[model samples]
Target: MLAKLILRNLLHHWGSTLLSMILLSTGVGIISLLLAVNKQVEDKFNRDLKNIDLVVGAKGSPLQLVLSAVYHLDAPTGNISKEEAEKLLTNPMIEQVTPLAYGDNYDGFRIVGTDSTYLLKYNSSFSRGSMFSNPMEVVAGSNVAKKKELKIGSSFTGTHGLSKDSDDDHEHFKYVVKGILNPTGSVLDNLILTPVESVERVHSERHEHAEHEQHEEGHDEDKTTGKQITALLLTFRSPQAMFSLPRFINESTNMQSASPTLEINRLLGLLGIGMDSVKAVAATLLLVAGLSIFIALYSRLSEKKYELALIRSLGCSRMKLFTLVVSEAILLCLAGFAGGMLLGITGMYWLNEKAADEYSFTLITNNLWNKDQFLLLTGTILIGITAALIPSVKAYRLNISKTLANA
Candidate 1:
């Protein structure tokens, strides 16, 4: 009977009920989106950082080098000689070396010139065809293939520079898609891989007007194109090298240096500030939703004073009367919470699709519920109960004679 009464009352105030539902759902949806993105980005980061012990790159801010080389974002920190990367491979503590060369793009995706070792480190394999075998042959990431609609034999020209609006298009050389990697959901998802020599060949052909010109500053073992690498990925021979090697690479040479684990953690801490603000705002909205429930219930009690008096005059205890009114409070909270979670999940994907339409990049949407989400729901529900307390007390203190006389 109480539930029926509550439903009927809500039906009568359809405008307020609908507004409350929208507000609650919007609050939860925002929090859900935040949680999904934070988890995914962090997961990709830790997975990529696992293999690389020290990153050696050109002389600039070590953080810049890491951002360009490791994360594959932004421009390179200037180029390190292919010779410099080779020397590190000879280190007694070094296990493997993967040199990365930059400065080119096919469409909006970054074209990274790297060797077989880079793919091998991630345990990545082509679902179709094989890795790049020669200069100008390229391997497309899963996202790259889908975005560019590229096939194994498809061809495209790379731009000379990194800018989204570069005029110097490298139409001279054709990059042939040789392979498409299985999706790994890391930085690899949106990249193209090729031989480090390709970076030189394309640019060298462009600047071939300059001739080899006594390449004095940076080259190694007959690097005919005189190309410099953007960075080197070092897998040290043992755990001890994790500490000793990065320092040696930093101090002993002119190159910038980084430990991926430490740097990424710092980056995450910085990102957490933005997430904390979102969570705080979600919490504040939940409080407002609870207050809405309280106000709506309290006003109903005011208009229904004769009804409360009739029930009280029939010998209903103050405690029972209080509980009867508070049940509506519980129903409001639950209805809002369910509506909120439902909108959060569906709306997040819809928003992601909308964002993908604007920016060329697509946000990944395969997220699942976790502890944090449950805790958030619990916290919001607790706030709802706390908000209902004052209205519930007012319901308990009803005087039958006074309320009925006024009615």
Candidate 2:
């Protein structure tokens, strides 16, 4: 009976109730969306950064080097000579050096040329077939296999560049899907991995073919540079190497080394500023919603005093009148909370689709409710109760005879 009365009262003042609900939902939705995106992005970054201490690549922005070499989110600065990178393997402080060569793509998925160490580092295992052991043999990531419908022994020629739109297909050499990897929820999930020699072989042949064509035209130009890999993922034996190695490589060698941890932290710090601003806006909206609820209830209490008094005369307790007033506010906030959750979930779904399409990345959406969202629910309920308190008190203390005579 109390709930029905609260519902009817809210329906009678539908315009103001809707306005408050919209404000609350918008605020909650924005905060919830940020929480989901931030958590997933940070988790993905930290997951991929595991086992990788340093990234040695061509001289450029350290952050870009990390983004490109470690995360495969951006174009590599440039290629570093394989011979030059191999020199780091001799260092006593270095534990593992995984060479990465990026030059081609299949259906928008990057083809990374690295040895089995790359898979081992991510603890990846075959979903179906065996790992690639020979040149031109490739292992497809789970997403690549599913999206492109690549089966074991399937053959596809890569486009000459990183993008699927590149028309320069390497028709001379084709890659066979030797294996498909189980999803590791890391950067490897979208990559096509092959032996480093395969990438070197393809580009080497392309360079040779171009040179031969030029030679035939009698315009001989030396365009050949020795084998180059895009970057090297380095793991150090000791923490001391972190201080000296990146500086040595940046200062002494043509290549630049970047620490994934440092770069990612810096990136998060920059992102935090934008997130904080949005949080402030959401907070402001919530405050406005609370104020709106307060004003609406306070004004409505004045109009409903006679009705409240008549109910009191009919033996309704003072506490029940107070409960009735507060219940209305709680009902509106509950509706707003439900709408907000739906809005946030829809926003996250859209964001995941956009991220996957644009960056070949997707945010984790499995757990929609977390501690922060629970706190949001608690805070919302508190706001409802607080906003209706004064109005409820007025209802509780109403003079039935005086209100009835005034009416």
Candidate 3:
């Protein structure tokens, strides 16, 4: 009987009740979306940082080196000599080395000149065709192939630089699509992989052509120097190397060494500040929603005083009247939370699709029953209970004689 009365009363004031629900749901949805997106990005970054201990690049900010070499999200600082980078392999503490040669792009996707070891590092394998076997042959990531409509035997010229707007098109040297890589959910999914030799050869040929033109025009022929690589990703053979290697490279050599773990933590720390501010705003919205609930219930209490008194006169106890009001508030809270969660999931799916299409990046969406989400729901429900307390107390203390006479 109490439940039926609570339901009917809520239905009677559906306008204000719905407004309160929408406000509460909007607050819940914003916070939930933030948690989901932040966790997904953090997880993806950690997963992609596997097996690589340090990144060695030309002298510059260590953070920039890591962002460019490991994450492939920033521009390279500069280039170091290939010979200079190979000397690190001579260190007994070093177990593996993968040199990266960057400088060109095909439709906003970086053309990464690396060896088969690069693919092995990410645990990537071909999906359709085989890996690039010779110069002027390249393999595309699954997303690249699908979105760009590229296939085996298709050919395209690369731009001189990483940006898609670069007009210095290397039309003289075209790359044939030799293979497609299965999605690894890593930086590799956004890259065009080829042999380091191919990158060197293309630049070498371009330099030679310029020199030939200079010689024909009665100018001095400019001689090109030794080859350079953008950076080197290395793994340590011993735990001791983790402590000693970065210090040695930073202090002794022209190149700078960056620890992936440290740099990533720093990146996340900076990212957290912005997220925290947004979370604070979401929290404030929740408080406002709670206030709205308080106002709505309090405003309706006067109008319902006579009905509450009649119920008390008939049979309902003061405790039952209190429960009736509290239950209504809780029901609204639950409905709002369910609607908010649905909105959050839908927003995340849309974001995931957009990211996959534009950046070839994947966001983690499989883990929805996370503790943070449950905690938010629990907290929102608690807010509803708290908001209903004063109104419920008023309902319990209603004077049947005075209310009935006034009515």
Candidate 4:
């Protein structure tokens, strides 16, 4: 009965109630969306950076090197000589070095040329088939296999560049899908892995072929260099190496080294500023919604005073009148919260699709509700109760005879 009355009252003041709900919902949606995106982004970064102490790549922005090498979110700065990168493996402070080569793509999914260590780093195992054992054999990530419909022994040629739109297909070489990896929920889930030699072989042949064509045109020039890999992912033997190695590599070598943790933290700090600004705006909207609710309830109480008094005269308790007014506010807030959750979830789904399409990155959306959202609910309800308190108190203390005579 109380709920029905509250609903009917809100409906009677539909315009103001809707305005309040929209304001509150917009605020809640913005905050909720930020929380969801931030959580998944942090989780993805932490998961992918596991055990990776440093990244050595061609000289460029350290953040770029980390983004490209660790997350595969950008193009590599350039390629480093394989021979030069291999020298770091012999260092006493280096426990492991996984060299990565990037040059091609299949259906927008990057084909990463690294050894089995890459899979082990992500704790990935085969869901079907076996690991690549020969040149031109590849292991597909779970996403690649599912999206591209690659089966074991399936053959596909890679485009010459990292993008899906590249028309320069490597028609001379056909790569066979040797395996499909189980989902690891890391960047590996969006990559196709092959031995470093496979990438080296493809590019090497392409270089040689281009040279032969140029020679036939009477431009007798020899342009040759050693094999190169995009970057080197390194794990340190001691934590002290984290402090020493990046500086040493940047100062002493042609290649630049970046720490994933440092770069990611810096990135998050930059992102934090933008998030904080949006939160402030959202907070302002919430404040306005609270004010709107207060005004609407106060005005409605003035108009309904006589009705409230008549009910009191018929034996309705003062406490019930207070409860009735407060319940209306609660209902409005609950409706706003429900609308806000819907808006937030829809926004996340759209963002996830966009990220996957553009960067081969997807956020974990399986669990949307968390402790933070629960806090949001609590805060929203508190706003409602606080806004209605004065109006509810007025109803509780109403003079039945005076109100009736005035009416």
Lowest lDDT 10-mer window, candidate 2?
A: 357-366
Per-candidate Cα lDDT values, in order, are 0.77, 0.91, 0.87, 0.90
Candidate 4 weakest lDDT stretch, 10 residues: 357-366
| Per-residue lDDT value at 11 in model 3 | 81
Residues 1-407 of candidate 4: C-alpha lDDT, one tens digit per residue: 76787899999999999999999999899889988888888988999999899999999999999999999888889999888888898899999889899989987889989998888899999999999999899999999999999999999998888889999888899999999999998999899999988899889988898898999999988875589999999999999998888888888888999889999999999999998999999989888999999999999888989889988998889999899999999999999999988888888888888777587778666688899999999989999999999999999999899899887
Q: Over 4 Å off in model 3, which ranges?
A: 1-11, 208-224, 317-319, 349-360
Clashing pairs in model 1, backbone N/Cα/C closer than 3 A = none
TM-score of each: 0.87, 0.95, 0.91, 0.95
Using lDDT as the measure, which candidate wins?
2
> If the candidates were sorted by their lDDT against the true structure, best first, what order would they fall in?
2, 4, 3, 1
* Total backbone collisions for each predicted model: 0, 0, 0, 0
lDDT of 1 by residue, 311-383 (tens): 7898878998787767666666667777776776676678667754233334555545688778767766676
RMSD of 4: 1.8
Candidate 1: Cα lDDT at 370: 83
Which is the winner by TM-score between candidate 1 and candidate 2? 2
User: On residues 140-229, what C-alpha lDDT tens digit does candidate 2 reach at each position?
Assistant: 999999989999999999988877788988898999999999999999999999999899899998888888899999996986478899
Task: Please give the lDDT score for candidate 4.
Answer: 0.90
Give me the displacement of residue 169 in model 4, in angstroms.
1.3
